[model samples]
Target: MRYAGIAWTDAGYRVEVLDGAGRRVVEPSSWGAAQVSELIAWLVELAQEHPLAAVLDSTNGLLDGPMTAAGLAVCRADPWLLPPRPRFGSVPAHRLAEQALRTPGELARVTAEGGTLTGRAEEYFEGVRRSEPIQAALTAAGRCFEHGRRDTPQVALTFDDGPDPVYTRRILETLDRYGVRATFFCVGHHVAALPDEVRRIVAAGHEVGNHSWSHPFLPDLTPDQLREQIDRTGEAVARVTGEAPTWFRPPYGALTPEVLATLEGHPTTMTMWDVDSRDWSRPGPERIAATVLESAGPGSVVLLHEGAGDRGQTVRALPTIIEGLLERGLEPVTVGELSAAPSDRTESSRQPAPAERP
Candidate 1:
C-alpha cells in the first residue's frame, strides 16, 4: 500500500507519494487549480499501479468532492494535530504523507456524502438541536440600508460566505496588519464547521453577521423556511461567538417584497453595501482593488468575500484596498460602527439591492 499527501498551495496543490518503507515513491509535483482533472487522472493511474490512498490537509476540503467523486480513497488530516516544525511555517506535503503512513487512524476518511450546501445546513442544525438550545427568532428587523452616513469618514470592509479554514485566517492577518476592524457575514454551515475561526473573528474585534443558513435565494423560501434559515444561522453563530449576529445580509443582496415582509420584525439589521468589490466573481487582484478604491468613499460598505471558493485574488488585493481607503482619509470600521452614524443621511449615494432576479 502507498500513501499520497496533497498539500494546498496558491498555485493549486503539491503532491508527495511514499511507499510502505518510508521511501519516496514519486518526486513531489505541483498542480495548478485549473489542472485538477489531470491531477486526478495521475492519481488514478498511480492507484492502478499500486493500492493507494490520498491524504489532504483539512483546509483543503474543497478538493474532497472532486477527488472522492473520481474514486480516490481520500482522507483528511487536521493540520492542528501535526507536530510543529519550528522554522517551517506550514505543514508540508511530505510530512502529511509521513503522518498518514505512520498513524493512519489520525486521518478521517472522506466519502461522497453531504451532497449539497442545503443538506449540510440541515445536518448541522440537527446536531445543534440535539446539543444546544435553539435561539428565539429575532424580535425585530431593521430597515435594510446599503451605506451609512455620507457625512461620516468611516467606511466598512465586509466579507461574506466565510469561516473558511484557510482564507479567513489569511484575511484576518491582513486586517490585523492594518489594525482594521471589519465585518464578516458568514454562511451558517460554514460557521458551524469552523466555530473556532468565527470565535477568532470576534476575538480580533471584527463584527460577524448572518449571511444565511444555506445561502439560498430568500424569495424562493416559504415564510417558515426563511425564518428557519435565519434562526438556524443565528443559533449556529451564537453558539460559537457568544452572541447572535446583529446584522443580516441576504444572500446575493437578494431582498424581495415577500422576503422583506417576512423579516419585518426580525431584530437583525439588514445590511447591504454601497461599493461592491465583486471579489466573489474571482476577478483579478488589480480589478478587485480598483473596484473598491475607485468607488468607496465616506460611509461606504464595501462587499468582499473570504470563502465560498478560491478567494486568493481577494486576499491578494486586500492590502491595497486597505491602504487605498486610508489614503482617501476614510476609516475602515465595523459595520455596526459605520452604520451608527447619522441616520438622516440620504440614500442618493447608496446602491440599492437589485430588483429580485427573474
Candidate 2:
C-alpha cells in the first residue's frame, strides 16, 4: 500500500508510485496522448492493486481531462516546479539570474548548482511565492459564497504616490462632499515629509498603503535594500498614523523576484491599479475626470496620483469623478473595505451586487 502521483512537466507527464517506505516503486513517462492514456490506465490498475491514493498535481491534472474525469484525486505543488518561460518574449539572462535568487532549499540548490540559472530567476521565484498565499486566500474566500452575489457594476477610486499637503487636502474635501472614501498608497518619504497630511488621511477614514520608501524599482535593489525600502516605509507610516500599513503597492506596479521574496509573510496586500488617470502627466482636469469615469467599472482600482508633481488638475478632477460614479450608481470605496465587502451572493445589511472586475 502506498501513494502515487502524476506531474505534468515541460517534457510531458511523469508518473511516480511510492511504497509504504516512501520509496519509489514505479516511474514512467508518457510523451504522446496515447501513451499518456495507457499510462494513466496502468496507474489506475496499480492503484487498485496497492490500494494507493493518487495525488496528481493539479496543473498536470488539468492537461488530461480524461484522467481527471476518471476520478483521480489531485493535490497541487508549486506551479513553478517546472522550467520557466518568458512571460512574453525572452528575458535577459542576467535578469533571470537575479530573479532566481528567491527560491529556497532544493530548488535554490539546483538553480545555483546548474550555473545556467541567474540571480534574477531566483528573485522571480521568490516574488511569485510571496504573493501566492494572499491570492489563494482571496480566491478561496470568493468560492465560499453561492447566492445573493449579483454581478452589479461598481468602481473604486485609488490615489497613489501621495499624502501631499496641498493636493491631498483638496482631494479629501471633494471626497467628503460626495461622502466617498478612497485608498491612498503613500510613499514612505512623503509620509515623513507630510505627517500631518498622512494623519489627516487616516483621520478622514481613508485606507493607507505602503508604496515603498522612495519609489525605487524593487528588482534592481539587493535583498537588503528591498527590505529597507519596505521596512522604513512601514515604520514611517506607523510613526505618523500610529498604525502600521497593511496594504502595499509596488512602485510603478513593478515587482521583481527579489522584491517578492523580501515581502514574504508581510501583513500587506500588494495592490495594482486597473485604470490610469494620467494625473501625474498634468493632463487637463476634465480629461482626467472623463478618463476615470469612462474606464471605471465594478472592482476597478482606478489610479490617480496625489503627489510626485504638481497635481492641480487631479485636485480639480476629483469632484467630477465622484459625481460621475454616483450618477452611474457606483460607490467609491477604499481597497480594504472593498476586499472585506460581502461577495455578490451574500445578503447582508450592507450587501450590494458584486461590482464588475476592471
Task: Please give the range of 10 consecutive residues that has the lowest summed lDDT in model 1.
Answer: 132-141
Clashes of each: 5, 29
Please estimate how well model 2 matches the true structure, expressed as its whole-model Cα lDDT: 0.59
- Kindly list the per-residue Cα lDDT of model 2 for residues 12-111, writing each as its tens digit: 3445566655566665444432244466677678766776544432122122223443444323223344343222111222222222222222122211
| Candidate 1 runs further than 4 Å off | 1-142, 342-358
Candidate 1 local lDDT, 151-212, one digit each (tens): 78889999988877788999999999999999999977577667899999989988899987
RMSD to the hidden true structure, all candidates? 14.2, 21.1
What local distance difference test score does each model get? 0.73, 0.59
User: What C-alpha root-mean-square deviation, in Å, does candidate 1 show against the real structure?
Assistant: 14.2
